[model samples]
Target: MRAVITTEAGGPEVLTLDDVPTPEPKPGQLLIAVVAAGVNRADILQRQGHYPPPPGESDIIGLEVSGYVSAIGAGVTGWRVGERCVALLAGGGYAEYVAVNAGQVTRPPEGIDLVEAAGILEVAATVVSNLDAVRFKAGETFLVHGGTGGIGMFAIQYAKARGATVLTTAGTPEKLDLCRTLGADTALDYHDDWVDGVKEATGGRGVDVILDNMGAKYLTPNVRSLARLGRLVVIGLQGGVKGELNLNTLLGKCATVTATSLRFRPADEKAAIVSRVSDEVWPLIASGRIAIAHQTRFPVDDVRAAHQQLTGGNHVGKVVLTF
Candidate 1:
């Protein structure tokens, strides 16, 4: 089997495809013959040495994949060899084969191409878990940053599908338009005072939930953009980690702040999220309530170019690697 390995902590150039031993399924896991893999922002972090794989997990840098179940580990049932499936992972997705926990695997909704399904689960699971934490409800207004990115695109449509009035921020006009097309009620320019735009969009009452990937760079404003009792879930730290906040304002609004990494979660917890996604979100997708976000695919051998495409920040949706 061939897999991508980072030669050192550095740029996309550090990633190289090389022959590696194919893994056998551990207890309660499944060995998947990879069809395609999702490339994500976290992959860049790992490639640059900013993020390391969790202890005892594969050092490979992918968080989701679509593949066929080639074998099942002991104690796993309800799965058969040769069934097409997808999975959320702690690591080890960028390869010809990956071993994932059976509890974390899902069959993609029928009728969608198995290859395009690769990029959907990781972002869907991320959005669903964060929104579920916030208790986001119908009729509430939701705001997400980077609305044209993988997570952002899905977040926009998923929130709308659940009946929330959606708001988003993007750096380019075309990107902002796509956000609106995906169901955002308002699209603000990230290059401008986006918080002010949020205020204007909501008529100053603020939003009920915020899905922020910018971390410290948007922390204060995200707080300022919340309505009373609002929740802010930070799922990325593309911005610097350290930030200042006004305790007085947070208290006044009765708002809460949380940060989570799907890749760092315990297996049982990830299994639960994956279950929710398969049972709930997948239906929405199957019924056409939630549309598939756009995607760009590259052959697995072009791993460096895939990383460059993601880091370049111009790709409209999920960047994927085809086996």
Candidate 2:
């Protein structure tokens, strides 16, 4: 079986396509014949040696995939050979075959293809878990940073479907328009005074929940942008890690801030997130209530190109690698 391997860590050029032995399913896991895998920011980080796979996991870079089951390990049920599925993974998705825990696998929506399903698991699970943590309610205003990116796109659609008014921030006019087309009530330019824009859009009341990716750099502004008792779910810190939080201001506004990363979680915890995503998000996709718009696909051999594209931040939506 062929797989992409990083013989040394540095740039995308460091990645090489190599023929490796096919991996077999371990207990409670399922071996999948790889069809497509989603390329994410974490993949780029892993490639550059900034992030490593979790303990006892494969060194492969991908965190999610869409494929057909080739074999099921002992103690696994409700699955069989040749069943089409999308699965959340700790690593090893960038290969001809991947073994993922049965609890982390989900059947693709009836009409969606493997390429589309490949991009679903990670973003879907992330959005669902963050929104659940925020506990958004109907008629509330929800603000999402990086609205045109992978997780932001899913956040926008899911927030709207859950009856919240979505307000998103994008860096360019084109991305802002894309957010508006995807059901955002307001799409503000991240370069401009986005807080003022969001305030105006929400009738000066401020947003009730904020899904933030720009962590420390946006911390002060995010706190200021929140309404009374608002919740801010920090899912990524693309900007930086260290920032001073004004505890007094946070207390004055009665707001709460929480941060999480999906890749480093324990298997049981990831299983729980997958279960929730399957129950809440799968039906929406199956019924056409939520839409996934992936803008690019690269062949598995061109995995380095995929990483470069993601690092350059030029792609509008999900970037997937096909086998």
Residue 66, model 1: Cα distance from true site in angstroms: 0.6
- Candidate number of the best TM-score: 1
lDDT by residue (tens digit), candidate 1, 1-323: 99999879999889999999999999999999999999999999999999999999999889999999999999999999999999999899999999999989989987788888999999999999989987888999999999999999999999998899999999898998889888999999988998999999899899999999999999999999999999999999999799999999999999999999898899999999999998878888888887888888899889889889988857789899999
lDDT of each: 0.92, 0.88
Weakest 10 consecutive residues, lDDT, candidate 2? 307-316
Candidate 2, TM-score vs. the true structure?
Answer: 0.96
Error at 88, model 2, angstroms: 0.3
lDDT of 2 by residue, 37-150 (tens): 999888887888878998999998899999999999999999989999999998998998999888888888779999999999899998888787778788888999988888
lDDT of 1: 0.92
